[model samples]
Target: MHTRFTRALVAVICCIVLVASCARLEVFATSTSNTKYSNLDSSKWNLVWSDEFSEDSVDTNKWSFTIGGGGFGNNEQQYYTDSTENAYIENGCLVLNAIQESNGEENYTSAKLSSTSSWTYGRYEFRAKLPGGTGLWPAIWMLPKDINVYGGEWPICGEIDIMEYMGSDRDTVLGTLHYGNPWVYNTGYYDINGSFEDDFHDFVLEWLPGEFRWYVDGNLYQIQQDWYSADSSGTYSYPAPFDQEFYLMLNLAVGGFFPGDPNPADWTSTKFYIDYVRVYEYGGDLTPDSGSSSTQTPNVNLLQNSDFTTDYAGWTTWSENGAVFSVADSTLKADIYTTLPNTWSTQFYQNVDVYSSTTYRVSFRAKSSVSRPITIGVEGVNNAALFNSTFTATPEWQMYTYDFSPSVSCSGAKLLFFLGNVDGSQNVEHTVYFDAYKLVYLDRKREYIFR
Candidate 1:
């Protein structure tokens, strides 16, 4: 997944507040454990596949080489080849080496390998040590097995980036999901306290129906559930692109759009080491305790004056490009007089308390004088995004609903709606209206099922 770095949507300002209290349901798994894996519990997961890289050479039955020098759509400087000089198994690890030797028109040569097998939903993990040098880009990613299934290629078929590391920035790693016809993507990053080149670390992606979670060294960092894919006919149903089988890819690219051109003075060569690759599937059932059955409580709206009966009591509106917000006719109104640079330039939001692992629903009725798109999501006080989705607002009023669960508890969270021009493309003035905004807590019940 290659994309240009763009401006962030949220600007976090730290604030101290009282943490909200929440009650959690206790559930237990009764299955017996058999596996000896350290990070995974045998009662919940079953190892389905793995590659330890102990063989004397690259396993041709499991991996195939992708050889080229056309930059691979990223204007990269490296020419990928299957030569052992670029890729080979050494000391029980799969080594991918990037050398400065010229191969035809390209000034550098590297290697890329794709798994022969594909999978739909599972836990994918990679343990590896990253290479560091100016202009080096190492990645462990996935692409759909059938690219033409969802209309066209590339973004339409979807891409899951399990891990991507820049040689220059050795402390940060990115996990991203690429989808949508016009090419929309969501990315999450983890900042390692130390350089990734110092040692091998575990990068994992737990992908299930409609949900994707990313972790580094067993620490959960990012989660995303809102995405879409479309073609000539129309938008496919929820989770269409991700529902298909996808194969794994490992590559070390030199220079190009992501990390820029590598500086030859920084290093003559670098090596990426992979200790293993493993996959797992859910095996056993987890249910609630027999004495305490799952039950739902009455929904309680957490927002104040949601209907704008008197004024914007608990809501706040802000803009950088002179957009004005007011309460009119029992609806929250925004009048945009000028175009903005970013989608979040003109914003409307409210602070709310959020509980970890608890589900919350946001419902609202909205419309715009001119048809356009707006983004809505929940963000932490420190600017970490919990969930977000883009929606088109037509002249006719329509109801919108979103449900999400925060992975971590936050005393201060913002539920925001962004009405500025999306992608800096639309530069016209328009008015938008929001009414009947409601944020409610949805209590989840635990139900136990015997195996």
Candidate 2:
């Protein structure tokens, strides 16, 4: 709909005057974060909305372009435009490409698209492959559907970063939330096994009452609950900023606060290919009892010798790759120096008896010398992890738990804690502490539901 005069005027505007910068990831390390959790099943949830991106053009009904050229809040260098050169559909995918040219203003050109619709709570999924190059920042994130709904700006309205990647770091992806006080929030890390740019992967965000979870290809990397928002009078609540509807946005920016600067040599017309996007409504069978405000007692503890006050009497340890295991009075020391190029190096386990067709919760206390990731799971007869996730270990002892339903009861079922996988640091040497393990049955009628 742009006329000849409008197009010519754009062509004669101006020139690039400055380079942009990105926010440093280091700033988030000091944020007020939350613990990890693993208890979601996409197969059990119902789809509420989806876009396969099978059409040959940008669907106007589903998405609208965020067109501009000024530093997009992050001092970014790209001028986002509506041109097909920057965005289009190809081979059943929505492609958002960042070019090393200008729109008579910024030094770079790219495309940004925002969903026309928004929702309150659902599992948001984006399956996409990224382009490679230093300083390339591709993000799939969300903002409050109505920023003024809370009567203020940004942090008060809340922000959710589903997946954020920097070309400078090819193997890591970050998921973060911004609410309450600025830059104070929760985040998760994704250490990919292969080049993320080489294949398509699913980046997901699960938002529910009092919780937020992030995952990459079904591997839950993070979950958060300790976030808040303040009102105009500075009064805050538990889930204010994030309890409202939010809309989604996708874009590839060049040179920003987090990714630093871009390398012009690596600019080869790469595209951010999105395979599809989906949002699901809650349809799980299990939920918490909502009959009364009074407290219901927790399920009785089913674990024995759980405190390790005696020793590793009911437990077993396995060291893989090049690692050594040692047990002192109360701690299990797994000194892992090396690992198989693509495998785990150490594991600590205990077998427990269980009743058939029952739901149980496993809880534990743990701490590690250095901040590292660990996987905990419950296995059946063949040691197949029926439930699992990666949680970070700090120097301080933290308590964690997960709930799962067993298909068949077994006497020799194993409960395991594993660390030092090939997907983690190649040269890992640390000790993790464990104590006070507990297991109990969760009421089948009691589930976590949004109020």
Candidate 3:
């Protein structure tokens, strides 16, 4: 399944620097580059492979079709097919079309294409015009050549998302990396002032031994260097998963986990257009450059007295319908004496500063006197929903960790835990204990110079 979560509405400020050794950079308003797709100097790269889509039909030697339905792990509504109506070449461009029709048990039809070739590390580029409408989720991504490289499927094998766009949000695109056994991932977004469907834009990814960089129209936006893979045996070494070869995939999904179902009256059809795809290998000298470098400050936990060491010095508790909250022995306890009418009727929270476009990792250890579920999330002081999820707490203490970005920035955002009958099902009185709370910002502030 294409695992995805609620998106944040924060803006990221990034700078682009082109050195003398690099090729001259040109800015475009709403079209692809007139010359080569890459902004990197010609002396630094070798074009290894490319698909210009000049022919009237698809080149089967370089691409293959994945045909099936069953949601493809994302609860998607489209049934992928090899039919020419769904995927074809038109006007010197590859078109992936999603249409409303009954295909088997699915109510929609679409197409998915996978590249026949795979590579370990290189620069991958795509010039494409995205589709628009609610419920359309189009993506250009990669999967490992060997799914069992890390002893499991999906996140264990690792996935790289060069670009993913939800049709409802026409101005933003996402670049993400998925790895780790329990499915850990990091995502960064690039937004434009206008819809992507208006013109073709260059989406590029540079994959090296220890780092991955994402760029849009030659403007570098996200850089990721830390990742790992593990399984039942033990944790693999650094970069063990991404170091392997991976193949490319392109698809347009209808109503998946990332994008909700489309409205039948509003959207019956949409098309994702691809002008070309290219891959390049570094051919220049491999040496440190004096022109550019990067330094990272250590991540800091922003919560005060997170462990309840001072007995809720920075925390507050609110209860309705006879619930109670207390702190002792470095643990915060919540007792639900009666079933609450709403999930937020009882809350334990702390006000924290939250910034736009920044990702935060929230972690805590918790257990319940009786097996049950609780709601945890971050919300604005005005009760604006930022992030929230229901997690079950067992009799034994278990560590829970999640990464999220707020849709809005707030100086006093509530970091909260709701200790109420989650869905009005568990009405019996129960006590939950929480400890070792932490909230850390996964700072992405860094700079890089191509050597």
Q: Against the true structure, what is each candidate's TM-score?
A: 0.64, 0.59, 0.58
TM-score of 2: 0.59
Model 3 lDDT on a 0 to 1 scale:
0.74
lDDT of 2 by residue, 1-451 (tens): 0000122222222111012111122111111123222344547778888889888899989999877866655556888888899999999899998888867678889988889999987889889998888878888988877888764565566778888887867788888787653324444567877777988998888887766778788876655554657765764554677778888888888875456678978753368999999988777643322221122234765554577664554455554354666557666566766544333336666555555556777877788777777888777543445677778778899988777876665443667777756355435566678776778766667763211
In terms of lDDT, the poorest run of 10 residues in model 3 is: 9-18
lDDT ranking, high to low: 1, 3, 2
The residue ranges of model 3 lying beyond 4 angstroms of the native Cα positions read 1-42, 285-451
Superposed by TM-score, candidate 2 places the C-alpha of residue 297 at a distance from the truth, in angstroms, of 11
Clashing pairs in 3: 1-73, 9-407, 10-357
State the weakest 10-residue window (summed lDDT) of model 1.
Answer: 10-19
Off by over 4 Å in 2: 1-44, 267-269, 284-451
- What are the per-model numbers of colliding residue pairs? 1, 11, 3
* Error of model 3, residue 298, in angstroms: 16
Clashes of 3: 3
* CA shift of 49, model 2, Å: 2.0
